[model samples]
Target: MPALGGKIDMVPGRMHGLRVQAQREGRYRGQCAEYCGEQHARMALEVVARPPDAFDAWLAAQAGPAAAPANAQLARGQAVFLAQRCQACHAVRGVTAGGPGATLGPDLTHVGSRRTIAAGTLPTHAATLAGWVADPQAHKAGARMPATRTLDGADLRALAAWLESLQ
Candidate 1:
């Protein structure tokens, strides 16, 4: 408490749930009050507070498949994805299929539309995505996603761009 000057407070352990009355339609963020691991500070949670009608529409859009690649670069990225081991861990609906190991990682169907990645460790951008894909361990210490060091810079950018375009 003294180190923080009492400005910061934390409660460790699992949270049962949360309830809030959103006064306006906008995004609100929350982070874990409990200690998780080395990357605790990077962890983040989001609550998109909106009217019921807008919320319903948002849910529908989120439930839909990832958007198709709209250009040559995106298409190339898609092709690179199909040729990689990414399907073994992650899945991009309509682009990647699930198998025995598909459930190992999170379903990245709408990752592009999300604000953060690596459990909110980094912002959702092409550069960050590429960095994560290249070496997740550098960002998240215990990440299960392996490094894609083999991908050349151009290919990596293409892949990241394609992922960002999934929105």
Candidate 2:
């Protein structure tokens, strides 16, 4: 494969895959060619970019369960989540977060326990989740959910912080 922007020929069966240019300045994108499933188009691609140190911290956090803060703030954050009706499409184990809703999206039962989030687009960090929560379309265009613009400032922090606490 080409390192930067040059074209590289690839054989379907002989070569597993190849990495091309980064979509963004520091991000990359690729697709699976093998037709091994029903939804080939829905397989989707990934774009990831993060500084070395920040990526390291995110990796360490993803390797383990969420480390909740020891304060009333987290409780309030939980309240905020419930009040916002995020449970409709998401599931949080040991909580009444799921119901008779369409499973059109990924489960959030162990969101904080995952390494890369958004189907492996970015590191599963509080800030990333916060940004996603604030503006889903910003990160992924044509996102199913509409942007919940009501969340801001401390509310955003609390909600993101609480969601991250769900290990």
- TM-scores of all predicted structures: 0.81, 0.59
Looking at model 1, residue 135 earns an lDDT score of 93
Task: Give lDDT: candidate 2, residue 68.
Answer: 49
| Model 2 poorest 10 in a row by lDDT | 1-10
What digit string (tens of lDDT, one per residue) describes model 1 on residues 1-167? 12222223444555554345667777666666668677677666666778999889989998999899999999999889889878898888888878988878888888898888886788999999999998998998877788889999899999999989988
- What are the Cα lDDT values of the candidates? 0.81, 0.65
Q: Kindly report which residue pairs in candidate 2 clash with one another.
A: none
How many clashing pairs per prediction, in order? 0, 0
What TM-score does prediction 1 earn? 0.81
Q: Model 2, range 45-81, lDDT digits (tens) per residue?
A: 4445577787798677555533444578877777787
> Top model by TM-score, which number?
1
